[model samples]
Target: MKKLINKLLVNHSLIYKLFLYIATIILVVYLFPKGGQFKYEFQKGKPWQYENYYAPFDFAIQKTETEIENEKQQITQNSKHFFEYNEEIVERVKNEVTQKSTEVFQNSELSQEEKLDLNTRIATILATIYQYGYIEASSESKIEKAAITLRKGNKIEEIQPYKLFTSSQILNFLNSKIGTQPYTEVQNQLLNILYDAIKPNVSFDEVFTQKTLEENLNKISYTKGLVSENERIILKGDIVEGENLRVLNSIKNEFESQIWSKSNYNWIVFGYTILVALAFLMLFLFLRKYRLDIFENNNKVTFIFFNIILIVLLITIIVKYDAQYVYVAPIVILPLVLKAFFDARLGLFSHVLTVLLLGFIVPNSFEFIFLQIIAGIVTILTISELYKRANLFISVLQITFVYFIAYFAFSIIQEGNASNLNWEKFLYFALNGAATLFVLPLIYIFERLFGLISDESLKELSNTNSKLLRELAEKAPGTFQHSLQVANLAEASANEIHANAMLVRTGALYHDIGKMDNPMYFTENQSTNVNPHNELTPRDSAHIIINHIIKGVELAKKHHLPDRIIDFIRTHHGTSLVYYFYKKEEEYTGEDVDESYFQYPGPIPFSKETAILMMCDAVEAASKSIKEPTAQAFDALVEKIVNKQMEDGQFMNADITFKELQIIKKVLKKKLKNIYHLRIEYPE
Candidate 1:
């Protein structure tokens, strides 16, 4: 049992854990009953109780009656002091007339005869009415008929008035016939015009009847009663008691009968557990291939334990708070933090697996899961290469913008209330963004505890570490100076090629560290002293120089530098033969010597940066031995060496395309030219 427990605990694949978690959450959600207290009254032995509970016909009628009564009162007040001069009404009528007349006249496409005919006809009608003195009489007849129609039982629709007199024509006639006056000509004329305008269509008997008022009042009262009844029903019964106890009890009983008692919850829980377990297993398998370090450090086991605890805590929080769905924003920070500390591929895998797991746990639709994944991916990608805290903050702000856009899009698609933009939503989004900012510190701590080093940490290490430098200074000062020069050249070259400058410099610092074992064997350390290699054969001399690569690897492994620094120590030479010694052997033997012995045992340059370092180291060292170096000589020599290396295919694996190599050659030529400028010989 203990062994089984240990095996399960050590499983690192996120899929396995995800499946387990999903299964557990499914069990919990399935077993747990949904809904809170019911919000309606329960009637015993009533077949139509539910219908009655929602019915609001009486309330609707009451509201309708109240509205009609208000309308009637407004109309009565408006009609008081009939025929009185209303400046607003008269101005409105004049504006309408002027607007209509201008519109008709501005139709220039109409023939002049047509335009004149229309105007003349209107004038003729007005003249005839004025001459007959019928305006005053007609206005009185219209007003009286309108008042009588209102008094009758007929509705406003049934008492149609003066359909032939268009609003524009009435306004035009009123303005032209009745000029502006207080009560003498203008007021009386306007009244006569209004009366004549309305008289032809009035239903005098209907308007004068008392029964019309009674009928309107009855309709209004009936509508008010219906509305009141609905309102009362909405607030009917011991609402608090019924909703809290009886209705709630009925819903609970229904759930118990339909789901719990039927063992549907059990089936759901079982299915969920199986699915979750399967998901976790798949995740474990996926991660195991790339993240073997987790297995080596027992992190897999610890992670499983942590996940279990997290799951339990989350479940507790969910149950206690009755949370509809988890706030998935916090999970987005994890992948970013992981990618910053670990390999990007591993971080991406973890991100995808976690999102899938969360999707299962979350109760929302598939869209929510998709949205969460998108947000997480954006957040992670933004900060994946971050080497500074400021970048993380900037990424957080970017993620905040993405989240708002995504949320708003989701709301729009869901047909949610988007117009109700309130402070709460702003505050919620602000708090979520702020929460992401806070995640950085926590991620930092977690990364450190996990023995993970971010790119920033590696950069910091490059600047501060001086153990190799100090060792070189004490044991091989000459080699130290040579290493410094090589570092300068390599760093510049690496920068030119867009390679890692810090790695190049660090690699240069330690590339010749093996010389500390026998400093006298190297020419750089033999200042004002006997040449050690002069006594030895060229083969033996080349052997000592070639052994440094192997010796450096051994020393670096002992010091426990990372694989990248070790790779530099290994590939810096890239199998190029020691030409001087090979030439000397040829001169001595008067024949070609064995080329294999003269060559440094090398796995050819595997990366662009290492290839650059190899070229720079050779160039910088060879330039030092040139006596009275001129710009032309230096440029020729540098070009010759670079071309030889290129011919030898030393840069084949370095990913240096031909175009980049051409640019590199030009840059080197310029640098060498600057270093070896023309100068006049001084008198000795």
Candidate 2:
């Protein structure tokens, strides 16, 4: 079981990578829109590309949106208003008026007969006012022909609430009934009392009104008519307007909703799976062909796929609900992030594949693809230095501008006019651009998560003010100066060979940090003639020398340096034999020596940057021993030193070409001559 576990652990990269691809394929295939692709790609006002479309089955001719809206409005306008009767309000007002009338008659200076007549008249007027229902005043003078279930006393009577009277109508009725002149004071008092008592006893019932309106509207059949099977719906080049467009749209909707057999749906799923699988396959091939290092590193490949899946999943959700704002998803961030860690080519390729997959879900797939592809290209072009704060801002502006222009152009081509451009979409474009600026922090987070080093981190590490490098300089000044020269040589060669110069330079800066452990034991830091290694045996000295790689690795981890920089410490020696100590031991003891004791425990330099560092370290350290730094001597010394390391097979495992090594040798010779002030000969 332990052996099995070890085997699995050794080959975990292959296992997880396979799992990632399978999982991605499953996720995309499942999340993809299940409906079959609409066969025809016809747009409104554009000439049809296909032959005449015939009705597949006898289906209803549904109404257009405009027609449906108009019908709904008519139903609402014609629907009767509902009102509920409140007898309590009417009775309360009537009793109060009667009490007031009694008080008035009691305090009157009129005769008893006249008081009786005034009381009777007041009673009659109250009855009449209560008989007619009043409504809350509205802005429009609409006559509400309403029915009500009257709640009079304990008896509930189903009757008309009586013809509804507006405020003006009620005032006119009162004026006519209470005639002018003969008993002006009594009439005026009676009219004033009635007006004050007239509150709206009938209230609108919104719930019942809405329910009735919906029920009536539902009764209006949406299906106006049906078309026979095999009927020619519309001809090629025929304008689909008015009733023809409605029928065609109804056919489309019905066609979409029709359920197929389970087996047929399986076929649709299979087809969608093929398309999605192809998209991911393209990405895998791209990485395999052009970026094999990233392809081999499971973490890097995972980050790329994660970004792709995240973008696709977000777009899927957006299209599932509101597709109008799909453009606001910041899909361009995929390219920007990929470019940050890797290069522009990989970033743009991943982004294009992701956008194409999303194109299957978004509405107007053509326009969406066009807009997103253009934005992605712009992102790749404009975003050169991601670590620079201003570059990201400017790149985002360029991406947004590209989206704006592309969308505007596509809209013009489709709509044939700038007048109908969707000005609101520009807001979504700007929002997407602003959101893309968030990729900077995202790059940092991914760098931490995957144990990957980005250029931004490289720049920070290259600073001499950093705690680890500063300590190295302070404790061992000679070693620190040697590291600086090595960094310059490595960076120049890296640039010439099209490798990462910043990465190599950063690695070179911290490569010999372990030498700070026993500064005097190393020659560069040994200021006096007294040697620490002289008192120690050759084996002990070799052991100390070989352990610097180990100690350097420990210090780097303590200071929280990244793994990429730590690799330089691990591989700078590249398993080369420490010939000085081994030869010294052979001469003194005159016995067989174990080569392993004098060799570095190395997993060698596996990348070009690390390989370049190995060469630079050897060249710079050997140059310090050169007695006269002349041009011919410099050339011979560089060739001899580098050739010895090459013969020892130190660079075999490193992914450095012979030509790149040649370039490194040239760079080292020129840099050393410059350092030693070796002047060129001027012939007469």
Tens digits of per-residue lDDT, candidate 2, 1-684, equal: 999999999999889988999999999888887775656655555665679888878999887766788998999887866555577887888887787767766776778987777677666655665674666675123344454444444554555644555566777777766665564676677778878876777656677668989999888777788899999888888765666667767787676667877897999898888888888989989999988989998889998998898898899898888989898899988888887788889988998888888877887777888788888898888877777889889889888888888888777766678998888899999888888878878888988788888888888889999888899999999999999999999999999998888889999999999989888889999889999899999999999988888899999999889888999999998888888999999998999999988999997888898989988999899888889778999899899988988888878877888988898889889988889985669998
Could you estimate the TM-score for every candidate?
A: 0.50, 0.83
What CA root-mean-square deviation does each model show from the true structure?
21.2, 5.2
Global lDDT scores for all candidate models:
0.59, 0.83
List the candidate 2 regions with Cα displacement exceeding 4 Å.
1-13, 44-47, 60-85, 107-109, 120-227, 234-252, 586-593, 630-637, 673-684
Each model's total of backbone clashes: 41, 0
Residue 16 lDDT, candidate 1, scale 0-100: 61
Query: Residue 391's C-alpha lDDT in candidate 2?
Result: 86
Candidate number achieving the greatest TM-score relative to the actual structure: 2
